[model samples]
Target: LLTPAVPTLTGLMLTGCYKFKAMKMDVIGVYTNKMSTDAYRGAGRPEATYLIERMVDIVANELKMDPVQVRRLNSPKPSEFPFATACGLTYDSGNYEAALTKALRIARWNDLLDRRARARQEGKLFGVGVSPYVEICALGPSKAMSAGGWEWGCVRVEFSGKATVITGSTPHGQGQETSFAQIAADRLGMPIEDVVVLHGDTNVAHYGRDTYGSRATVLGGTAIVMCIDKILAKTRTLAAHMLDVKPDDLTFEGGRFSAKGKSVGWGDLAPAAYVAKNIPPRFEPGLEASSFFEPENFTFPFGTHIAAVEIDRETGEARIVKYVAVDDCGPQINPLLVEGQVQGGIAHSIGQVLFERTVYDEQGQLVTGELMDYALPRAHDIPPYEIGSTVTPSPSNPMGIKGVGEAGTIGATPTIANAVMDALYPLGVRHLDLPLTPEKIWRAIQSGADDRGGDRIPEADRSAPRYTAADVGDGALQVGNV
Candidate 1:
């Protein structure tokens, strides 16, 4: 079976930053002798981002041009969105240049360059890397997903004048409980403490497209909003009946319905809904609603990440001195939650780039299968992050929310890898595979060789292979021997 990662390879890769005239992607899933690969954090997005961002740096280095300038020249302007990419996906909304500019400003880009120069004078390796990335998320419309791409939410007002929200989107630890409650409470004009959110139980929420691809807030929260609207419509009609006024004459505010100097609060309305005594004609005797929200399209969350690193010439140990990330994931419901998600995601990316690795011997047996053998990042390994955001509300949903759960992971891997490459570039190291371990860096520094064991070519003399006319057919360029 083709996993979600397959389409992600093409859909996300070509649309990260640049606007390509034409593109093609071929997926060849080789069945290895050992275990099969499955989805991880960011799925295929991190790999796609790594490929494009690394190529941007390579192109910049070869042409002696600023990578930032190259990116700006290729990126679509803000007015150009709902931009359709050559990869057969349309971006809902973004301000790629704005995110990039904010990240650079926060990182003090020019000052970082000067610091690198000074470090070089002191016989140190200081490198700065920037990666601007865009990820497709909010799971999406049913037409695009095989399993179905809708979320379920139910809101029921209890007799106690409190609300209970049951969502189909399961939250392991993304703080959906708090964020969803906040969303529901605001719409109901009730105290947040009066709302209770429940999920992760199939018996409770029997129908839903559970959370993945950062759809909890966008798809799931929108579903809740839809349910709330339905509940309010019924409540207004019932309230007008109780007040002996037209539904249009009744206004709702602060959990109360008012008409002509008379008002009824949720406390009174809830009991009336259950009692069924003199309620609205032909109306249901309960205050509850359920919704299944299917989004029109996926949300596009873009961001810029900048990393500053210092490499020890003798030990080949790289230390991240500074990190800045500026993301645009639409209007945040809770800024603190966004920051926590980004910070956790960056830590996950750092582990993949610098520490975590899986190994197999020539005999195809697992080697680093245990924690003692494999590595994971510790708290100290994560550098302090400078978090920032630019709001570009998505047009795909009523809440205008985009996803942020995977943005840091999607952007940080390339940013950190590029920084390490930049630091090793002066030592004549052209390329190195991850996880950029200390031994690998030291070996590369000593041999001054590329990953393929070729001698490093000078910038002026180096040349990349060109695609011929035969390689282009129907505006698509097939890469590799697949």
Candidate 2:
């Protein structure tokens, strides 16, 4: 929405940063009579990353080179921190090799080499694939965004030491409230139950962008910390006066202020601040602070995802035997939350490449609008992810956190696609597009209907594609219109 054209839709993420000589990306935005296209789960980065990752495997097969070696040779190293790619963007800091190495270990790449040899001898389809991907997140450098990209957060402490945080990023179900509370409680040295996070009411809260582009924790959480800083500064002055010591001499821990040999609990100190009794000179009467924090640069969250799968040559069915993901979204505040995000994103990505496809017919209508026609992956369709991580903190943010919400989705699409291609490579099949249905694989094996482009299925009802009232102008849906 910031620009007339969706610039990043073509080439934004690490596609431009790969350092491959004489690399060119050609992108075209087309206008169709069907429904307008917009962001999917991972948005532009996933599509662009998937394309290049798939091409890397294709080039490896053509050159008789190992895919892992090919990627390792091309990926930038730790020495190249803040390196700019041919695509006209700079990477702040990352260790692509470390993440890839961890992913390989989790994926058991060494064992896969032996498995491939034995599977070939036994006439079985077995393969391993990897996609090392980086996504530009925290959608910042507000100037580049051309509008609103900052977050607003405010913190207020009651007289009883209870705290309330209001963040601009309203999260529906991302567990943002719980994470934000954790940060506040740790910073204030208070019990977690004493701190509460609030959002969803813009009228009562400050103004900023809502939760999209995975900006909640990195942007909104940081904003809350900044606001807490203001409160702490005011409280420290009050705390010092109550302890009868200099502000610098007072130290805080376990919700108590200690100076030399004297200490005061938050329960006693908090109410004293508002009471204006023995308060520090020029100190405020109540604790309330607000901060609108704009991230200096966008966070680049990178990771490697590996997939192992075996295909049934007889019926052209694909089964994911094992899946491994090694992601580094910087210092994780909660490991379970990070793992859950990776798992959910992997499921979404795998679904897109295997079962889900938005199809339009010759009449410019959506054929898969209903669940009966649409083929989303069910519980049985997706495999469990074995997740691991290597912490390579970002230097851009104070918390050194990079966004992980979209990392799994960014890495999984190509990993699964490559695994399928690896399984079919012995049969001379190299490249294929998404929604790798059994019919396409069987055709590619038997008669070489090499999968190209997206779903090409015909409309189920063979009816006219989306002919809305605007198109009819005169609003006439007669018997023949069907």
Candidate 3:
């Protein structure tokens, strides 16, 4: 499916940190006689990041070089902004080294090394892992997207001096309402409560790209900004006419327009614009504007995530003792919202790496069809997160914001996986597929085998009859014979 293929191709192109002299990729979508795969939280980004980060660790182990040094030696310098990858995408702006530095400092890299040594002395399998990831977001130019890449925004300053922002980008739990309000309030110099954000209603917001690929804030918010700029232009003319001053002479700030000695606030001018009296000649009656913003290039958000993992020798259980995430999504409109998104994404990553999995039988029947069979990370499964940020503004938009929606998921998956792999590397385990289960780890430790293919159930167990729910009464399910 196009949905699956897009991310798959994206991942294939972005599988390495170093600039390669030559590279080739082939995408062959085959029918597995199973349900079609589609986009997930991080889509292809997590898979791509996992591939590169694990390979980096593997190379480090082989060369006896520090993984950090390997990264530093190969990464593009900060001056290489608008850097073009050999794979055919141009990064808007980034400071990969800065993010890495911040993450390492926050994670206390030296102390972590000492701790790992001490744990080893105690006969423990302790390891530290670091992953620096850059992901393409804000969708891109319209030519690259099957669907239109631009987003629409409408801003209307009501007669009561309150504002309403209608955007095509629909926000689910990413808190776009609050963030959009913040943007509008800050730009209009009005109270945050005075701005109301509306979306996800087709009748209200007739046109939109509908908020995927972390384009809500970058594209949609920028559209709102464009609308605000248009509205301000009209307001400036109206204020200049009313104040009997040249438009260039009037300065607008704090919801008020001021001249040499006279000023007009929103309360005075908003009603005047509608009243059509004492306003600029040929001025629009309503204080409203709409804009559609199409970004010229994709904004690349890069970050570094470090994880300290400790494995129990006896049980094969791996626990993350510490985690540090330093991300750069340009400037955060709301730090709280960004933090919440990152925390949720990190939890999602943790689930994907250690717990979540989908299984199938020889007949292509779904084995892990329900939540009871598929394990998800619980509240206690997450480690305390040390979150930090670097601000490397993208030139794609005036706000300079990239997207943080998928940053945590993209960065944390490989960070934790690399840590687990690092711990197993000492035991002669070279490679393993995801959802590093206890049994798999224990078997690897015992046999020194690589489970790179995936978890395989014994044929007898795979063919065994399994329980399925029939009808349920009184909240009790009746088990049906398989």
TM-score rank, highest first?
Answer: 1, 3, 2
Residues 1-482, model 3: lDDT tens digits: 55556665465446455666566666666767788777778778888888878888777766656677778778888897788888788888878877887777787676776776677667678878899999888985799888688999999999988899999999999999999999999999999999999999999998999878888999999999999999999999988988999999988899999999999988888898888877666777989999999999988898999998988777778899999999999999999999998998999999989888889998889999998998998888899999999999999999999999998999999999988877765456667789888777777766643333333333343223111111111111111110
Number of the top lDDT candidate: 1
Candidate 1 ranges beyond 4 A from true positions: 1-7, 449-452, 455-482
TM-score of each: 0.92, 0.90, 0.91
Runs off by more than 4 Å, candidate 2:
1-10, 14-17, 21-24, 448-482
Clashes per candidate (backbone, < 3 Å) = 0, 2, 0
- lDDT of all predictions, in order shown? 0.84, 0.77, 0.82
How many clashes would you count in candidate 1? 0
Instruction: Answer with 2 or 3, whichever has the higher lDDT.
Output: 3
- Residue-level lDDT tens digits of model 1 in 1-482: 43635555545565578898887676656667877667777888888888888888888777656677778788999999999988888998888878888887788776777777677667687788899999888986999888789999999999888999999999988999999999988889899999999998889898888878888899999999999999999999989999999999988898899999999989889999998887977999999999999898999899999999987767777789999999889999999999998998899899888888889999999899899989888878889999999999999998899989998999999999999988777666666778888777777777763434544646443333112123222212121111
Candidate 3 positional error at 65, Å = 0.5
How far out, in Å, is residue 312 in model 3? 1.7
